[model samples]
Target: MKPQHLLAAATLVLATTAFAAGDPHDHAHAHTPLHGGVVVEVKDIDYELVAQPSVIQLHLRDHGKPADVSNATARLTLLTGTEKQEVVLKPAGDKLEATGSFKVAPGSKAVAVVTVAGKPSTVRFVLK
Candidate 1:
């Protein structure tokens, strides 16, 4: 391979590694599995924690899921400036929803806490 190609490839890999939030076990924002019917295609996903409603809504492009997340529970931790806010989630039918005690403002770092089949699970996502 040409030197330039190798350099570009290395930089691409480094960029992806550098942006990772934290160590896998250190944070709740971990890998999330695609459950339900046909996994929906979510693009430019946005997340928010509304303290008053005790709910976190995952806003993304409408896609089809094979099943519903009605029985799922969502947990969330908002990380920003060394601050972490923890929240619990409940199923909101199609969307895996959760309510949090902390009022996370817009553009906060967030991790999706999805409780699947009564077992505590998580989905990692950055609030954008």
Candidate 2:
């Protein structure tokens, strides 16, 4: 093969190899809700929000393992049509929970801001 053809072939091989390697931070795992709630994944962490009429719960998990939320706090904003409600959740047992009247319904949306050890992460959910 000619010198130019040889260099082009080498470049093509390296590019193909790099593409096949894929991303190191890519998490292609399934996120199934443990509490029968809406689950969202952020930065490899899963946040499940179980919104009920009388209580709200936010569960955190990292790679299928329960994440530590003992020093964490969460604030949720729930929107159901024209009605909006906000609630603050404290760490309770293995999850963050709050007890109060909430307007959670089908097709409702929620935005949770969870802070753990001074770092905060936000997760959005749509109730079904």
Candidate 3:
């Protein structure tokens, strides 16, 4: 290929790669688990689920800041093998919490349907 043609092709490839990489600043919005639980993000909000034998907690955060769960409610479905358990969580302090005898073990899965300000979002997690 001619020199000019090769230069144009290289520039195009570089531009495409950069565009596909997305904005570097977007890393600031990445979600991380805060309560030593599994975290999933939906609609720019982070939901962390902490599953324990005696209690379950769901923590919410937006842009790394604690989100208000004062009026929010969540319904969690816990799956362990063929046994499924359901629990309703209500706002308690800065997180949604429910207390009961739960079956939480390694490799258990849970799905949380959370509602905040009339908007509902679903978050799924696999316990470790």
Give the TM-scores of the predictions, in the order they appear.
0.43, 0.79, 0.81
- What's the lDDT for candidate 1? 0.49
Error of 1 at 46 (Å): 12
Give Cα-based local distance difference scores for all models.
0.49, 0.92, 0.91
Compare the candidates by lDDT and give the number of the best one. Answer: 2
Model 1 spans > 4 angstroms off: 1-54, 59-63, 99-101, 105-107, 118-121
lDDT per residue (tens digit) for residues 1-128 in model 3: 99999999999999999999995545576577879998888877889999999999999998788999999999999999999999999999999999999999989999999999999998999999
**Each candidate: RMSD to true structure?**
10.4, 5.6, 4.6
Worst 10 residues of 1 by lDDT: 36-45
Which candidate ranks first by TM-score, i.e. highest?
3
Which runs in model 2 stand beyond 4 Å of their true positions? 1-29
- Ordering by lDDT: 2, 3, 1
